[model samples]
Target: MEKIKTLNFAGYFRNFAPILLLFFITSTGFAFQDDRDFNEYSGEILNNKNGKAISSAYLSLNNSNISTVSNTDGEFSLKVPKDLMDATVTVSVLGFQSKTLPLDFFKVEGTEVRLIENVEELSEVTLYKATNARLLVQDMLAKKDENYLSDESIMTSFYRETIKKGWTNVSLSEAVVKIAKSPYNSSKKDLVSLYKARKSTDYDKLDTIALKLKGGPFNTLFLDMMKYTEYVLRDEMLDSYNFSFDQPTKINDRYMYVVDFKEIDESDPWYYGKLFIDAETSTLVKADYSLNVDDKKKAEMMFVKKKPSGSKVYPTELNYQVDYAQNGDKWHYAYGRAQMEYVVNWKKKIFNSKYKIDSEMVVTNWEKYAGDNWRSENTLIRPNIVMVDDVSGFNDADFWGSSNIIEPEKSIQNAIDKIKRKLD
Candidate 1:
């Protein structure tokens, strides 16, 4: 068996982009020191008509900022403290009718919450008023200061990443970090400090190669396109893209304009995705984009930082999705996800290995920064960070567990179980 080595995240993009750190180590401590007396409410969010699992559904506690997103399995867990048990939790998604229920309605055994698709169409007048999708997006990007939070605040977020070799899970890493979120209108980057993190990797499953995701939660934070315009729609790069309108829709009763965008300049065919814009406020509420990796050479440059001398590695697909939450007229980064898939070929070996890496971060709770009350015992303020459990000497106390997280998909849970078997 090959031992996993500690690595640093190295990202300097000729095209701009990056997730997945091949990790192996079983660190199962609940690292949820979000300063809340949390009582995790667990459930599965589903589609009412098809009864299919609804991934990426947003759940929030009523009259408060606490919220979370459903996992790929449509499973959800919300950590509500004892004082908030009387409050209601609302479940909402892009195309679904939001459902709200009192805390008493949910059962610890796992409640099922379903939402119907919101098929309401846009009036001709609404479409006519916004004929130019590019212009509409431009207007929305311009109003960033007014649409997003303008003051500095502190946020407690949960982050998890998994690595798989072929069909078997090999590595898992998860963390809960404190963010000194900067004002939306400014260019200052957010500062992060690792509050708690854990990882478990199945080394026996790996034949030789190990993958590492650089930057961890810091990279995911930059996915907030509204706050980090240069990361996606820099003024010069905007002209290179073609923007068109898709079917208009409603999210949380707000009139929304669905705009589809793709790179028109093939020389740098970088991304293509959809934007969910709030029609009235011209705010970008959600964005889904992926790097156009048809040119294998370009994909390699963007992701494959390093590998063994004789081994070949190239990214097959890279997809990202960022979601925002509206509290009154202001918005904040709600959730972000990055999925990366690659094919690895060993020089002397006939059989090749396929690897898939996924990482996601969610803002569970936040408050306006009272600068005096803030301090990080183990801070990670740099732009590039690696969370190695053994190297960092992770302590079990206050570490996060499966709660306040996107419930793992069946495959990931199986991987965790397999590793746990060895530990037990």
Candidate 2:
């Protein structure tokens, strides 16, 4: 029996050896450190024209040896080595003009850097003329191939994704997902699976898949909407709504021609928003939009009687604020924040749950292949899934029992695999 148990353990390890190797490699390479080799400095970066805080602006010192980006509030903390006191700090945003300052110029305890917007031909222009120009551009864009609007196939990268659930306003459970190329054959076989610590087991050897269908959520809701320019303006799902360009603005250093979309018909979905497209590449950069849902009406009509007693009825509002950044030549979604507001009415008891979801992806590496052996070579890279337990706002029983759980890595890998199979 002891020998049999040992054999079983060995077999398990063998099955997951590739995934284990990836976890070891990634953990060692991306470990976080608390101690810095240099002293840290704090400051705020703002736009000189409007004096507004510039978020996500890249700042580097001593020729990129030390670098950081400003936070959403335009605040930054960076470490500068004492030896490089004379080195200048450079600040740059996408579409915006870059600024540099000598380290010696800042003598106070903290520094405030102001960046001025580069005057482009569009900056001093009137809104009405810009709208006309943008309308013409949109008309041209809508006539292009709709397929181009939603091609995530452009993203060819290896990344590890993590997902977690929150309790008491903190993450309670977590999971890690890793996807990399196979060693023996890179094209033919791609492995995918999930790991759960609560189960003390790993789900391995699942095949990677992609979606080929044109109208799925991955294509329609995300990719196509993101790659807006790929579709001609006439192809937009505007119903009777009219879209016109407003003004050219800079976001994250990228110049975006802001397009206003409004409803001409009340029957059309509430599609009021602005699309930020890269001025040079014409790629979609960011979209800020909102949608309305009558949750109370839906709940009253759709709720099953068997659900939890004292269940609440609520009016739900879904808000999505999404941003995309250019990764290489393609535009990939970098970060997204979604908020669902539910106004609950439980037997006249009213409350609200502002559920928020934040997600981001960083592509560590990408490789493209156009050969016949792509499928065979794809098999070598195995997927690794790590299940993490959420300890926050949990009783010992809840923590041990498995009531609260999350499987982020599995979901992400599944998404990748689905896309792959569809494409294949």
The number of the candidate with the highest TM-score is: 1
Quote the lDDT for 198 in model 1: 68
Q: Give me the candidate number with maximum lDDT.
A: 1
Superposed on all Cα atoms, model 1 deviates from the true structure by an RMSD in Å of 3.9
Model 1: per-residue Cα lDDT over 339-416, one tens digit each: 878887878889988888788999988888875444433344455455564413233323354236666788877866
RMSD of each: 3.9, 14.5
Q: Name the weakest run of 10 consecutive residues (lDDT summed) in model 2.
A: 5-14
lDDT of model 1, residue 389: 43
CA-RMSD of model 2 = 14.5
Every candidate's lDDT: 0.75, 0.39
Query: How well does candidate 2 score on lDDT at residue 375?
Result: 35
